[model samples]
Target: MPDVRYVTQGTRAAIRRTTREDGAEFVRLARESAAFHRPWLTLPTTERAYLHYIGQLEREDREGFLVCVRETGDIAGFININNIVRGAFQCGSIGYGAFPPAAGQGYMSEGLGLVLRHAFGPLGLHRVEVNIQPGNKVSIGLVKRHGFRLEGFSPDFLYIEGAWRDHERWAMTSDMLDQRTGAG
Candidate 1:
């Protein structure tokens, strides 16, 4: 195993930038988490796809991180900041999922908190958005817990699995994070 450089740490989990070396582990984890993610999102489950994903994350407009268990150094989940628009916009969209062993364990919550701090503090992002299907109560709850507000709904917002899926847009700003954490 290569050295894992954590970008940020929380009590139970840490976030690290995703790397090409993470391909195999991510594929296995995707398989393990398939049932949990089937209705919500899709992950790279093959080596080629994983490599492609790594390439995508390397782009300037995107960033990816793996949420790892702090004690055991195991991958608990992944979060990606995508479609970043710099300059006057300073915004990004995010997608994420938790692996089975970490599911419902609050690791993702800690990881998300760390990621938001990283985004607003170091990355200089002013806003982050998430799109969730209305039926995905767990995901909805996750964003709400982090203080994301429902902005609107989009018909056929994304193409997923075998069809176009409708999504509810949720967003949070740097000011919101600062207010939530009392850091502003």
Candidate 2:
């Protein structure tokens, strides 16, 4: 059994750390949602790859969380904070994917709010950045809904699928979140 650790909770969903036991279900979801992902993102769809994915997250610079529906405890999506930098930076890049069943349901929005709170609170992060392919409107909208501001654009920023893809950078700071919530 996976040692499920709840990272944070929201009204309709909860964020929890990914676990080794999640491999099977995670891979199944990734495989089933392949069409939904396609050129946008690539996820671990095999057991071996899943294990490697988990191992990568175990590194100090990365953290992965599963967004699960509160009512049913079913995974709605996944979010990862990658390339964490402390000291003067105190920042990390974010990557996320919503499963087919959970897409367009607003669950990811609620779950992302929980993640922001975790990032600013326990994680002590100052800023979080997300890079999205320009053609992926859904992903851009998701970040916009969460108060991420457009930073800039990068040509051939990240290699996805088979070739290099252009991306738009979006970011949010802890101070910005506090301001939005009237806490700062």
Candidate 3:
């Protein structure tokens, strides 16, 4: 069982760490939202696969979170901080997926904002990067709305759905987040 930490509470949703108990609901949501995540993500839709996925996230370098509806506690989306690096370079790469019922509901936006806060605050991460495929306008827009700046582009940056895919690198530093929120 993974430790659960509440990141933030929003008007319609709350962001919190993913737990083993969420396996059934998470797999159901992933299966139902397959069309919405096809080219961009490959979420686990089966019980065994879901457990394996969560186990991987339990590793030291990765963190997983879920965005849930405040009123119902239903999962709306998920966010992951992967490849964390400490020491002088305190950073991580982020990936996310919004489920069908919550795809255009703005829950992801609220959840991502909370994730950023947690990442910069208790996590002590200095930077977070989101690598999006150029054609993924929705993903790009989400990061842009949160003030991520375009850092560069990578050819065949990652393997997705089989073939290597290109990606546009967008990043936000802790300093940038502080500047945006006027925290410091």
Q: What total of clashing residue pairs does each candidate reach?
A: 0, 0, 0
State the lDDT of candidate 3 residue by residue for 1-184, as single tens digits: 2224556777887888887888998999989888788788788989999999999899999999998877777788999999999999999999999997788899999989989998999899999999999999999999999999999999999898888999999999999999899998
Query: What would the per-residue lDDT of candidate 1 be over residues 1-184, giving only the tens digit for each residue?
Result: 3225989788889999999999999999998888889878889999999988999999999999999988877999999999999999999999999998888999999999999999999999999999999999999999999999999999998988888999999999999999999998
* Tens digit of per-residue lDDT, candidate 2, span 70-91: 7778899999999999999999
Model 3 Cα shift for residue 91 (angstroms): 0.4
What TM-score do all the candidates reach, one by one? 0.97, 0.96, 0.94
RMSD of each predicted structure: 1.6, 2.0, 2.7
Scored by TM-score, the top model is 1
Positional deviation of residue 1's Cα in model 2 after best superposition, in angstroms: 17
Candidate 3's TM-score? 0.94
